[model samples]
Target: MTKMMKAVVKSKKAKGAELQEVPVPECGAQEVLIKVKATSICGTDVHIYAWDEWSQSRVKPPYIFGHEFSGEVVETGDLVHNIQVGDHVSAETHIVCGHCAQCMTGNAHICQETQIIGVDRDGCFAEYISLPAQNIWKNDPSLSWDRASVQEPLGNAVHTVLAGEVSGKTVAVIGCGPIGLMAVSVAKASGASRIFAFDLNDYRLNLAEKMGATDTIHSMHADPLEVVRKETNNAGVDVVCEMSGHPVAMDQGFKMVTNGGRVSILSLPVRPVEIDVTNDIVFKGVTVQGITGRKMFQTWQQTAGLLSSGQVDVDPIITHHFDLADFEKGFNLMLKGECGKVVLHP
Candidate 1:
C-alpha cells in the first residue's frame, strides 16, 4: 500500500480547500482502513471552505474535513470482525464514546463525547480513511459508490421523516437543500399523502419536485406558508421537516406545522430566534425534535434498505461531478446553489 495519499486538507484559515498530498491513515487496533471510492461535498464543507464562524470555532486547520463517503475495506485491525478487504461499505461519521451515558441508555446518537470522522478527525475526502471497525457498514453491491457515500446525509433525512408517521400524511420540507430534497424522496417512499417543498433556490426547488415533492414553493418569490397552507386547506402540514438552518425558515416551519403536528428540526440555527413558545408549541401542541446526526446503526440500516429496495431515488439530486483536483470549483458551485449533491472522486 502506498504510504502517501492525495487529499484535500485545510491547513490554515482559508477561503477554499487546498488539494494536498497527505499520508494515508493507518488502521488502529479496532479500526479499518478504507480505500475511498467516492465522497460528496456537504454544507459543512462549504462552511469550512469559507472559514465561517462555525467552522472557525469548531474546525482546527491541518485537518481533512468531509464526512459523507463510502469505499472498500483495504485493511483491517486485529480485533475487527465480519469485514473483509474489498467489501463495499460506508460507516457512521459520528464516532461515539461507547461508555457515555447516552450510549449506555441506547442513545449513542447523542453521545456527548462524540467525535465526527471528518469534523473532529480526518475524513474521507482522500484516497483512504481509517475508521473504527464497529462504525463500518457493509453495502450491497447493487448500490453505487456515489450513492453509498450519500447515506450519511440520507440517513438524516430518514431520521426526520420517520420521527413521526409519514404514511398517508401530508408533509412539507422547509429548505430544499440536498437533505431536504432527500426528505421529500423519503417521505414519498414512506407513504406520505403529499410532499410540499420550500426553498429559496429555484434549482433546488426544481430538484425537489423531481425527487417526489408534490408541490414546490420558491420562497424567494412566494410565501411558503401561504402556499403550503392553501395546499393543505390552511390546516398546515401534518409534519414539517426543517433542513434549512435559517432563522426565518425555522420560524416558518413552526407556523407551517398543523396543530398537534410534529416538527422535526434537522437544521442547526446559528443564533437564538425570537418565538412565542406558548403559541408555537403549547397552543399549537407541536412536538419539536432537535435532530443531530444519523441514529447510528439503525438509521444506516434503514437508509441502506431504502437504497437497496430502490424506493428512494436520489439520482436527480446529483447535479455535478468532479475529480479531487477541482474541489474549489465544486464547493463554489455548491455555494452558488448551482449544483445539488456534488460528487468528488479521488
Candidate 2:
C-alpha cells in the first residue's frame, strides 16, 4: 500500500478546503520527494481558499494547494544528482521547460512554458511533495524553517526593489501585504533614502513600520498621492514598488513616481486597469517593469545573503505560526489582513 500523508485539499469547486489523508507523491526519475517542514500562506493561496475568480478559472479542485515552503529531502530519483536524501531544501515552485526560448536565454524565471506548483499541479500543502530536481534549492541546515519558507516571497521583494538603483533614492511600496512589507525592509537594507509604505489595512501598515518603513500611509485615512507629494516636496517618489493589485493604488503609484523614475509592479490585478498612458508613461519617461517570479537564481542569492547577514530580518514580518492542522486559522488571519507572514509547521 502507498504511504498516506495529511494534506489540505481543495476537494470541491467552492470557497474552502478539506483536510484529508492523501497518498504521498512518488519521486520521478528526475525528481525528489521532500518532507515539508514549513509552509506559508500566500495571497494566491488565499485566492484559492476563497475560490476567487482567478482560482475558479485556473485551479482544479481535489488537489493540494500551497507553494511557499521549506522542507528536507526524504527521497531522490535515480537521475537526481545535485540533491541527496536528508538534505534540507526548498523549491522554485515554477517548473520550467529547459528547452524553451526564455530558459535557453537564461530568463527561465519568465519561461512561457512555466508550470507553477500549487496553481498548475499538486503543491506543498502536504507532508510530502515530489518536485523536479532543477527546481530544488539547498538551504542552510541551521536556518529556521519559518524564515526559510518565506524566502520565495522575499525574493519577489528583492527582485522588485533591486530592479533599479535604490541607494540614496526614495521608494514608495504601494501595498502592505507580506511581500510589500518585505519590500520596505529590502529598501531600507539597500540604503534607500526613504521608504513610504501604503496600505488600507492598519494592521499591515503597522507591520510595515516594524519592517523599517520610513512612513506608513493608511490609504483609508489619507490620500496616498497627496501624502507622497507633500512628503517629497511635490517632486514624487523615485521608485514605486506596486504590490497592491488595487487599480486605484496602481494608478496612484504611476502618478506619484518622479519623471524618469521606475515603477516595478509585482502584484497581479484581477481585472484590467485603465491608466493615463501619456501622463504616466510617455511624457513622464517613467520605466514600468512587470516583475514576476525571482530572477531564476540571482534574486535567490541576494535574498539569502540579506537574510543570513542580518541586513534584512524577517522575524518581525512573520507574525504568526500554526501547526499544519490549524491552517484555517492562518488563512483567516491572512483573509482579514490582520497578520504578517503566517507559517505552518508540519
Each candidate: RMSD to true structure? 1.3, 0.9
Which portions of model 1 show Cα errors greater than 4 Å?
A: none
Query: Clash pairs of candidate 2?
Result: none
What is candidate 2's local distance difference test score? 0.93
Instruction: Single out the weakest 10-residue window by summed lDDT for candidate 1.
Output: 267-276
Indicate the residue-level lDDT of 195 in model 1. Answer: 91
Candidate 2 colliding pairs, count: 0
Candidate lDDT scores, in order, read 0.89, 0.93
| Cand. 1 Cα-lDDT | 0.89
Clashing pairs in 1: none
Error of 1 at 82 (Å): 1.6
TM-score winner: 2
Error of 1 at 71 (Å): 0.8
TM-score of model 2 vs. true structure = 0.98
